[model samples]
Target: MKGRCDKKAHLTGYKAGDKLWVTDPTAAAGETLQWTKQPVPEYRADHPSSPPFLRYGHTATEYAGAAYIFGGRNEASVCNRLYRYDPYVDKWSRIAHGGMIPNARDGHAATRHGHCLYVHGGYDNDMEEFSRDLFRYDFREGVWHACALCDRWEGMHRDFHALSTVGDKLYLFGGKSDELEPYYSNRPVYDNHLYVYDPAAERWDRREAKGEAPGGRRSHSAFVIDGKLYTFGGLNCLAGEHYNTVHRYDPAANRWRLLRPHGRPPPVRRRAVACVHNGKAYIFGGTSPLIGSPMPAKSPAEEEDEPPLVDHSDLHVLEILHMAWAACGLPVPRHDGLETRPLLPRPTVGRRRPPARPKVRREVDHLRRSQSIFVRQRYGAQRPPLSDRHQ
Candidate 1:
């Protein structure tokens, strides 16, 4: 008749710590939030189902009780393959279809409405250009349909943007564009504009939002909860800026309000995957430069050997209704004095400390000596002196 207990276990049914962590709206103020990592399913080597290759910038949309993953780039090349994951069976199956298949691309945005998946703009590496076409996959019919690029949608080409479905419409927001003016030399230009797509009428409308917007960013994650759209951490490449801030947009008011949620936030990053399940926003893997650490200009060999940014494998959850953040069993990194500091102190884009003058002079002299030796070896006595070469 006694209840069971485990001393080392974080969850048990008998004690206060035994209860499962929940984001209940009516929970007491002192309720603790915890994250539990789910177990990965295993299968035999000969099994028919297998996982997709490691990738990023792909679209994963939950539709009809399964997750459908679309095109993304891997180390070798971009792909246009589609795979479906069934959580109930813990299996993955590649889907084969016949229709106007999309090009192999990455950085595209996708969303599900009803039973179909809508995929939009991405960069096609093979074509060496950004895609502006839209494609739709009808789950019920098992066919892919390419939507016509109407004249009105001509200037809406973009990649690394967020797309979310609200009611019967789709809302697209901030992303980088090659057509936009660069904020600094040799850097990407990002946009802060909002666009709405009406599938019923096949029309696109650009909405001019009021209030202080989160200006010009790309690779940010966004999701909709209770009719409001919320966006999180993105990078402003042109300004050499990264963000960990959160912003909420109310369609009814046509306004954006920056939200300062309670608890420690994830470090500044972009290209993170975010989704809403049971009123909580879960954010996963992304990339960011080291905090307060900027690299100086280096030689081409050094630049090739060292990476400028770091990739993250941590997960963080945000309680939407409560406006609080929780981590998944990992210690949240602290950004000391970040909230009180201005962003102007950060490194400017396309700028870095030059190498010491003496080092440069030495490199130049060495290059000249090497060239003079090569000329003497090739031409022998016919070669001119170093001082007479310029004359």
Candidate 2:
């Protein structure tokens, strides 16, 4: 939590290569103020046809007053386009092309290490074609370079893995080969092998861990906060099991530990993406099986009871500095310093009410209570909005 600030003097937006540790904004505001005064902020969504730049399986980072988004699928095709979004100008400009750049890919992993962008293995087209090619893009030099191709102990191409940057090394884990058909398997196959790539030495080496590691998963999310890699929620090997569990990896110890929380992680989903800002992990839109996937339903009753799912447009802030979670709806505004206003919370059923019924009129009081209950049941509860689900 060192080097973190939550006061008005330090309420800046998130940027890559910025401070990895920061104070929890909601927590720093005090528990009552966080929950009652500003439960969750509501941010309006952009138009549906905004742009194809920040589509599926891509990565984005903020730096130098601009947001850099690159490498994802556009429509049904793979894209290698690099785009820079200038908040000052409120516009997006194409900086690079997708022509023969990298394979048309999804399920790939990308992270900003130092001043360069590092991208690794993902599903090339279908889940069958996995890519192990590693590449890096340097904005300062305006160049791209191939780093390494991933391989298992038996020399097979692996994909659908989790990659993260911890300290100076890039780490990869829980991947399966292209030859492995995930659809037919009862559970996701576990590689249990850890691969580390060091950019300084340009060498690849395997690291061994001493504890129980997570099982093989595809489309899982990993982000570095306060020098630790926090991984959460993705598809597990089980037929219908989507992970809501959280795990933290300590690079120095080369170990994994489970994170316990009060409730399930939002809802079980996959292909989700996360980025760190001010020591908080902000998660945005991604593909979910509820929308597109090939799997049989377990039961009609279960399906009937399932809550409606959508491509999330909301942003979730995870405070790595204090180990907290808050649901946010507003787009990360392009403001910094003392000019930013902490977002106001979305209204809950408990807070808003109609005119109070007089105590002398017992019938009116009963009617009011019944009305409130009916409204609450019908609407359930209002959570924050998903303002940046992307076009």
**Per-model CA lDDT versus the true structure:** 0.60, 0.50
Candidate 2 Cα RMSD after full superposition onto the native fold (Å): 17.7
Name the runs in model 1 displaced over 4 angstroms. Answer: 1-48, 148-155, 180-187, 294-308, 330-391
Error of 1 at 102 (Å): 0.8
Please give the lDDT score at residue 66 for candidate 2.
56
Weakest lDDT window of 10 consecutive positions for candidate 1: 1-10
Instruction: Give the C-alpha lDDT of model 2.
Output: 0.50
Across residues 1-391, which tens digit of lDDT does each residue of candidate 1 receive? 0000111111111111112211222223324433332233343323446545555567777776667878775434456877776655546777876577777767788888888888888765444345677888888887999875624633356677888888888888877654321111122446687888888888777778987689877888898898889999987655556788999988899898899999999988876767566677777656676556643433211211112555564557799888999876543211221121222222222323333211101112456446545554554322211111100
lDDT (Cα, tens digit) per residue for candidate 2, span 1-391: 0011123111211121121112234554433112111111221223331333324555555446555666554333445556665544445566753223555555566666788778787654432234677888787777778886555454224455666778898888765542232111111244656788899988788877757676666666777777877777766433455665668878888897787654224556555556555566655434344534433434311221222233333346666656666765333332122112433322222222223221111112456445544554564422111111111
Off by over 4 Å in 2: 1-54, 62-65, 97-100, 125-128, 152-160, 180-192, 237-239, 262-265, 285-310, 313-315, 327-391
TM-score of 2: 0.60
